[model samples]
Target chain A: MTTLLVVLLLAIGVYCVAVLEAWIASGRFRLMAPACSAIALLGRESIVPRKPDLLFFEMGPIVLLVAALLAAAVIPLSPDLIITDLATGALFLNAALAYVLVALIMAGWGPNGAYAMIGGWRFLGQLIAYAMLVVMPITAVAMRAESLATTDIVISQSGLWNIFYQPLGFVLFFIAAMGLAFLPPFDLPTAKGELAGGVEAEYSGVRLAVFRLGRMVLVVTLAAATVTFYLGGWQGPSLPPWLWSAIKILLVTAAMLLIGRYVPRIREAHLLAWCWKFGIPLALLNIFIVGILLVVIP
Target chain B: MITAQAIFIGFFGVAAVWFGVVVFRTFSMVRSAIALLFSQTALGAMFLTMQAEFLGVLQIMMMATEMSIMAFFMVMFMMDPGGMGKMEMTHQKRLSWIVGLASFVGAVAIAVFIDWGPVATTVAETAEQTEALGLELLGRSMLIFEMAGVTILTAMIAATSVAIPPMPSPEKTHKDKV
Candidate 1:
């Protein structure tokens, strides 16, 4: 029952984000009726470029969606309420998200176009920039938790969230998360005006729709991860644990959208430079600070 | 219990059929490439199910990124002028058949004979594991390794800038005879 609920919640969350993006694009919020109609409109004909591989285009979205779902399954929503509480949950989550790059590459290669190829290269560059920063912060948090289990990470935060103790690490992680989600300032690969939807430009019809849905789900999963790592997943006063988690996730997702709107997009190379220079240093400093505090305070 | 097993079984069954169709499909090179791309993606998803999250993520990222680049190259350079005959891999008589059978037999032999070792117990499962891992990574041994990563990244930026095309030298106009 709990698994079903979590899946349902995830579906609803992804659907809501999709509707919101469309609404923002079209300037309308007519509730359910218009949202359903808009969703149906997304199914319109997709232009397949000549000599393109239909099988490859079709599978890109499926791979993304399945991976995201499987990753989410391992993340505990509350105590005693996980779908598959694996011993190596953190490693599993990292592995699942890593496949996003593969799917993007496939979509690019299958299309047989110059723009897609460039976009794929750009995406690879972004991955190199952000992966280390993201990993470092998570490592810091994991170190503080002193356990690999997601539940334990939450439990360890009974007194204080990781964000409070490791502010710099949290900031670095948040930035990396935004980049991974292709949100705003870090969204250079699909810089629509520049790359014309980047690697996804050639994809259309149901294939495009699936990719769009996958992106939305990926955003929510990232938000859920931030909650799990920093905000103390399902930990709050008064409200039920699951409800608390949902509320926290919603707030984080909202923050992501806001960042999308306000953050000015940086050039791809410039972003990579910033990550290697500023991001990596800050993350290392954060680890150092945490180490000292753990020794001195304890 | 039944539902969970059913979901799992259904996923595997679908994956098998999907993969088979991709392998048999006679399509343009672009199409075959795309199908191969998706197959890698499906394997990544399978990795997630096996509780190897990090590996799964890496697979998806690597495959998708590489396939996109491959597709882009095909579109940009492989087209015949006026779009007449698209490039495709023709069926080579009997060659693929031997390679496919040999691989299948090898895989079956390995599956039947391979012996797995027992899982080892580790002290890292306790409460201090995270702290210990962090301390170790930040410790002197890993410090140099981490520093090296940053240094290499810096060198990459330097190299890229140096490789950018320089402006062409101006043509020398005929002035007064030297």
Candidate 2:
């Protein structure tokens, strides 16, 4: 069935990214390193911390993974390959992804450790920075399409993708997507040197794997959404729509990882200031421009 | 066979009630906040079952963000935030119970007795429904909607200004002191 294939592709996409990340982290860009790492991890014992809130600690990673999958469900792999084509698919994706914040907080707070607590609260700061960055551009895109449905947004790009039109919006969205996924420069919540893995300090073995995998899935979902909302979901010439979707998602993921590796980690305070002072105002201006263009042209 | 909508409504209805109870019963402030989120999420799912997709998703997203913030604030302020001591959080035990039960009974009575308006004979498709709602808001209620948005924006700015901690005053130099 189409649904099963969509799920399979999503899983594989996340796996590929996770592998790529491990390769980067281990100082080796070998292809088989991630698989070997996974095999080794399978034998490790899952550890639960003492004096921790067990319920929330256990629920966190599962919820994060569920949220990622739920967000991905709304994305159309191709014209006929969507899991659920809700009228408000775009909004639903946003809503589902918002819960990732909750899961991160739960993970951070439940561990009852200084590093975990600090990491958890750091994500809140990250959310404050990137939340509007994600929403404003999506709103502008919806305005251009005059519809909230992902399918409709894609259709409006039959001639030209919104990326060409909403260049500023695309740039803002790209940065925020990375931030939301906690990739690279925005990975303050789990900064290894400073917080000793931050929200992930206490997690070990299977739970750790689940949490790490979920984070990768979050990256994959964000990339897929970028392709869906901006690059035009499954719209391409001289190739199958599903293949096009795959290619776009992979390209976006690679770009995020590449940018993440090259960029130095940003200070939390500086990032927050950048978001509030520069990002928010620019996003607002982009919206104003988009509205003017829409009215003037349409 | 039972319809999928009916099944989903039943599931979410029970989940909403269960989590609502959990919200008050939980000893930990963080747990209580998350329980409240679950309760809201279940209600949102119920709305989805009723085909109010936009409202459903809005409810889920808003509650998730709000509850995440609430949980953070609770941890920052509340003592024994992890509930290590398992402290009881309830107050006004007997009087509050009586008041709650009485309010619940009154709400049920009102719900059962009210002569609600007749339901629509037919419902529009999802796209048409959303389009119509959008038009209604932007076309007729445009002024009020925009005003409300502006009001919220102003409130946000005010809150941010108040919330940001004051910067430390510069220390006076010996020359300035002299």
Candidate 3:
């Protein structure tokens, strides 16, 4: 039951994201455009490149979809509405999503094209750049909560959202999440202008549909995570818990999608340097602040 | 519930072993790396079945990212990364068989011979276990985790420095021209 609800919510969130993206790209709001596009994609055939790695080509999209779903499983939409509710739910989400790297590398390598291969390798570099930015902020969050449970993290933000409490960590986490999703400015993996769609170059048909869906799911999941971590998740009054979760997730998704349109994509080298040098230190500082706050204020 | 736990443990253990075998059997370096990932993932699941939530999740999380880097390095070094050219994964068939059989027999004999202690049935709840783990990490074993973190950071810095070629000095260009 929880699985069905989360999937449905994720689907809606993805649709909303596509709508927002289309609106941002063009001025018109076409609600049905994404649905039409998905149907069109399903009708096309996924053409395999000659001498391609067959297993990787087949497994990439499926693994991506599974990874996103696995991530969504641990994220609590409401107090009682969580799936599994693992002790290490926060860490589990990170664990489940790590497969995103493997999936992309496989997808990139599967086609055996130069563009795809470069794009795949680019994400590996991106992984090196962003992995700490992702993990470190979560450490600050887990510190404040004194637990790794997603629900506990959310509850810790009840009196004051992590965004307000540790805005530095929130900012770092949000930026890292954007990079992870590879949204426009960070969309080096599938940048259309430079690498001719990069990793998406060789993918087509139903396979392409799955790949695209997987990406959308990823973006939405990251946004949901941002909300659950930074924003007071499901805590606003007048709305039911699930409704608050949905609204917060969608808003975060919109913000994440729209924010990328303004900034230029980060260079791979600069990303690695900045993340390790700037992001990690600030993350440590955030932890220190949170630690002091716990002691001094308590 | 006990039956289900046993079933999951058995399933993941078998899967882990099967994938471990698949790692050796595959001709492709990429496939072998991915097979190792699956083997590691199954082992993680086995940890979960034993109720070590943190260990299980950490194992899965760490292995997934590590394996991709492994895949990258393996493919970079291999002669046929795409597996188009069939290459032998193993050498010295008779010696390999003898070693493999001996290891299996030795493992089985140890398992059977050891006077294993009484089974621990009651397990700590996940939250308590997680809290205790947090305490252990932040309390008793703080230095170890910190050292691990610094070592990884050092490795990252070393890898980046190696990967990025140094900029050529202007003096070198002038000397070459002269």
Candidate 4:
């Protein structure tokens, strides 16, 4: 069963990569067609500039791909089907995500373009801003779950999903995750109008294809994590367990993509300020509320 | 199910060989920095496998981000983009190699000398682990930690704004100079 689950995860990862490649190449996924056309109409071209170093450009996608695979090893598909099942599953997930900064820096520096370099620095700034906010909410959730294992967190929500009790934390976490994932409104580092392709302006061909694929896979992975940690993964009735899990995951992914496509972008500094101000405070408030509820409600 | 010890052993073996190759084959400072970042990531993974959850997260957050930033700085400051130039691997290299070998030997020696014994079973099962963690986090201490985190963030933002270099005046334009 564990072997089957691992294989299934790998297959899904590969499928996500393929879909993203197809989308980037044709700029016309069934769901993303409108956004692609709008972007096209805006006169955005995916150009690869001259004399870019190949190694750095190529490494971005490779690192992202490897991170996704390693992250999968820690997620549980069923009761007994995790590859690693470390006691510190939350830590493992965060650790896996830390690879993104490295990949982004490599992509930015590898291209040897001024815009890409600036984008890279901006991304680092974004990382510092969002990471602090993201950690608090996730850590709050982890503490509320009492154990770090993915399955353990899901089971704790057997009585109630954390979102019901900690909506503020959920919202803060969702926004921070969106920023980290470079979703719409928060994708300042990659804002096409101002920074060309942001960190990836000089990349083309298979390199661009791989990075695009990695982005999609990361989207799916982050959505799955949000579900697993907060929305009660595979806990619904009237369906097989795995199917229920799939439904929840798809719903989150759809919501993420919808937001990514439709929302207007915010300036990088403003976005950081928003996170530091509203996001962090709300996350802290939720933690306090949860603590009070735990003490008084029983 | 593999024991933590076995996992540690496997990771140590792989990491040893990986770092060995990195030290031998890396020709430039930038490549060495990148190699160090990857090695640190591997170490963080090993820490997770060892069930040191907090430490693992800290390791990943600090090491990975710092190493990447170092790599970026090296590229920006150094003239060579590819880092293909010859590097000085002198007395520091020998010291590092000796220290690494000694550490490896010391670790193996400790593992061999320690007595093997039965360990107490964990109270939380795999399924219950996440729930227990959630419940634990709901304690009052976590709230205090969260508050401290916010305060620290505020200070950081304030410092950042103060440190940024101000934009130059428009009077120093090319037209005026001409």
Evaluating just chain A, the predictions reach TM-scores of 0.93, 0.97, 0.97, 0.85
Q: For candidate 3 chain A, which ten residues in a row score worst on lDDT?
A: A257-266
lDDT (tens digit, per residue) of candidate 1 on A1-298: 8789889989887766766655555667655743574467486887788866455566767877776787687677788778877655665676667667666666765576778757766876797678777778877887787666788788888899988988888888888888887876777767788888887888777777777777778888888888898989999999988888888887888788776776678998789899888999888888888888788864
- Candidate 3: residue pairs that collide: none
DockQ of every candidate structure: 0.21, 0.75, 0.77, 0.35
Flag the better candidate by lDDT, 1 or 4.
1
Report the candidate with higher DockQ, 1 versus 4: 4
TM-score for chain B in model 4: 0.53
User: Candidate 2, DockQ to 2 decimals?
Assistant: 0.75
* DockQ value of candidate 1: 0.21
What is candidate 2's local distance difference test score? 0.88
- Residue lDDT tens for model 4, B90-169: 56887898998999899989999998787755444543554555556667468876887999999999988887997666
Candidate 1 residue-wise lDDT, B116-138, digit = tens: 56644333432254345557777
Would candidate 3 be rated incorrect, acceptable, medium or high by CAPRI criteria?
Answer: medium
Q: Please give the ranking of all candidate structures by TM-score, highest first, separated by commas.
A: 2, 3, 4, 1
Q: Which structure is stronger by lDDT: 1 or 3?
A: 3
- How does the DockQ of candidate 3 come out? 0.77
Candidate 2 per-residue C-alpha lDDT over A65-166 given as tens digits, one digit per residue, 9 for 90 to 100: 999989988898898899988889889888988988989988987878889889988998888679889988999999899888889889888877889988
Mark the 10 consecutive residues where model 1 chain A has the least summed lDDT. A29-38
Per-candidate TM equals: 0.70, 0.93, 0.93, 0.71
- The prediction achieving the highest DockQ against the true structure is 3
